[model samples]
Target chain A: MIKRKRRIETFSFFDHTGICKHLEKMAVKGWMIERLTNFGWIYRRIEPKNIKFEISYYPKASEFDPEPSDDQKTFHEFCAHTGWKLACTCAQLQIFYNELENPIPIETEPTLEVQTIHASAKKSFIPAYILLLILSVLQCFFLVSGLLGDPIDTLSNTAKLFSTVCFFILLIICTVELCCYFSWYGKAKRRQSKVSFINRQAHLFYRKLSLLL
Target chain B: MPRAKFQTLTEQMFYILLCLKDECYGLDILDKVPSMTAGRVNVGSGTLYNLLEQFLDAQIIRETKVEGRRRTYILTEKGKDMLKKEYERINAQVTDYKNIFEKEEIV
Candidate 1:
């Protein structure tokens, strides 16, 4: 019998609420989140139970850390005191689980939570998006210039046209993601709102489909 | 843009400052809050951790001791001042409620 499972579900880095909800649903099916990896989210089979999942961000955490830093350990200790135990961590994102019924939430202050999310997002999400956006723009510019320079050659080659379409889709995705982040950050300051960068499942599916094409 | 840094304190923040009035361990705030409020208020550990950092940045709280990861903190004068202001603001709301409702009772 299989004891572990891995699934690729695209949950945006900022979408902790969404991730937590999904994990809870998984927990009820006797599979608990064990780790997050480049390949997928790993789950280990467990006795079916209702458990709560929480995500917290530590902007200073890095993937290169050999172990939890002193401050991170301290933070974990505090959470443990209230029934929230460390489940796993991926870079700045720490996932915690509590078996206690109605455990106190890991984040009580919405404003502070939003600030932490933004700080974490700036560390990873923003830079990646910026790099992807630059890449897409450069590729688009080169393709357009090539078409203008030699319309017959560019149009006739199926590969160039496909590359152009893929890069155009990438550019749109990057632009929308960056714009959504900024807009959400701006509104988050004025009022409390759930942190989300839009569901990326469909976007990811399209990207994969484009890659295959 | 982010509320001018500690202009108002949330209930959790208020309780955290109350816990730090005397030198206290950072993790102790997690338990102290709920008991102090008779379990009416609880500070999430993550919230407490981040708030401590933010309070330190704003000079509202200062580290008193560090026994490895078990650090101690105490509310600074600024933190005390903010707590007092929040107390007064809450008090004023209660006073307004009594002023209106008490008069209505007489009528």
Candidate 2:
């Protein structure tokens, strides 16, 4: 009988302790774990058979100054050793690995600006709609108060009645606008969360699948 | 303290306890295991976190310290006992399997 040994691949990344927390969370579901030391800094890996892999984490980069500290140089060397492609002078590090079962080349496009605009529009709409609703209520109050009073003269009284009726009509229009805003706001938020969750799950699945292949 | 022993634990929970046998943070354990096993297992952040909460609840592991907002974990006495018993059980199973195979060859 021929016994087949499973082929395992290894990938490493240098990142902060937080990334470790993310992996440890996954390890509880039966993924194997190991820590490796190259130099003084530690590297980590998560091995799951028959899974695609992805590793994403931030790494510490040193400050740029006239005179650099030894600590800064050391940090750069550590980041280089840990397979960090990009370095930022940030405290937290994130590293992630996904098994490449279905290897799809990532396409880079300018999306941040578009996303920012959409986010701002959504945020602006929420408050504007709320304000409109409030104004509508206030207008109704003025109209009600005016109707309860007798103006000093017939002309003034007639004018007050006309103004009160106009306010009521405007209030109805604003109320409708507020309702539309709320529906739009709720749908946008729900869709955003759903899309985010699905994207995460897909990334995870691909990462795991990469390991298997 | 004697490590708390469990009659059974899910494979992930056992591996987590085993991973914490030494000083480790979340990412360290994540990277260590996959390479050690040659990528035979990978744990994702969501699953790893939920299990950590369970182990903390079970008193198997405790957060030792925070380094710049990251929590490091060390096994508690009860956790050690649980790991020890698990190791013993696995060793026994391996031995039993080896003996069975050897006897079958002789026959």
Candidate 3:
């Protein structure tokens, strides 16, 4: 009689795009996905390999937590109960695992360029807000100065004209700001969300690998 | 007057803390929880992010910006201590439940 053992395989990837692609590839290769952890930055893929089964766990350097603090310990305990592991660091591309521990070295490549992109994305909103504020103040000033016309008859008409122009300008600025804010916020948030999903997946895979080891 | 101690956290808070333990971001928590629980628990981005902000206020987790538009989370010492206590308490409960079942079987 032959004994068959259940094989649980887990793998992690730093590149979110790559992780997604790898999952697709695994699906084609007849690997059944058992679990996934989506951390928004990386993903952990747990699959059933051949009868022998293999668990592949990778970590991104960006999400690596070197020291577990009290809160982190609680978090880990929660995750452990749920059978999940911490995701990889963002700076890491590959992962090395051993019994009881997985160590990922920090990536040396400069990430300032990426940071600059995020910084600029946030800073861009300031100018838009400032422009709107200026327009609003100017409109208020024009109305208060009573420069549009005479006290009674012309004042109302002139004020109407000035107010109309101000209103239109304000409307345009507000519309643009609203649209830009949503677009910027959406794109930035979506990217962040995707990365986080991947990160959580990576963590899940790491935990599975730990069990296998 | 002394404040009353709560035995369990709100579901949102519990999930948020669970998300942060693994260095997750606000958005990541938003995406992960629903799928993790097989759609039984769905946490929207707004609610999850707010919960993370609260955790930050409570000093349970801290945020770190590592990549573009990515803010990662790490648990604080206080958070870990709380988590350890919670784990012990829960483990004790599970043990008690198991013992009860075992006693019934023996009887």
Strongest candidate by lDDT: 1
Q: Candidate 2 residues A134-212, lDDT tens each?
A: 7767866765665466334523666656765665655655554445334444443544321111223443454345434
In candidate 1, chain A reaches a TM of: 0.87
Best by TM-score: 1
> Could you tell me every candidate's TM-score relative to the true structure?
0.89, 0.34, 0.31
Can you tell me which runs of candidate 3 are displaced by over 4 Å? Answer: A1-213, B1-7, B66-70
lDDT of 2 at A69: 44
Assign candidate 2 its CAPRI class: incorrect
Question: Relative to the unseen true structure, what is the Cα RMSD of model 2?
Answer: 19.3
Candidate topping DockQ? 1
After aligning candidate 1 to the native by TM-score, how far in Å is the CA of B30 from where it should be? Answer: 1.3
After superposition, the stretches of candidate 1 with alpha carbons farther than 4 Å from their true spots are: A156-163, A193-213
Off by over 4 Å in 2: A1-213, B1-6
- Candidate closer to the true structure by lDDT (higher is better), 1 or 2: 1
What is the per-residue lDDT of model 2 for residues B7-102, given as tens digits with 9 covering 90 to 100?
565455677677888888855665665566676655444335445655788788999877753567889998899888888888899999999999
Provide per-model DockQ scores.
Answer: 0.72, 0.03, 0.03
The per-residue C-alpha lDDT of model 3 at residue B62 equals 89
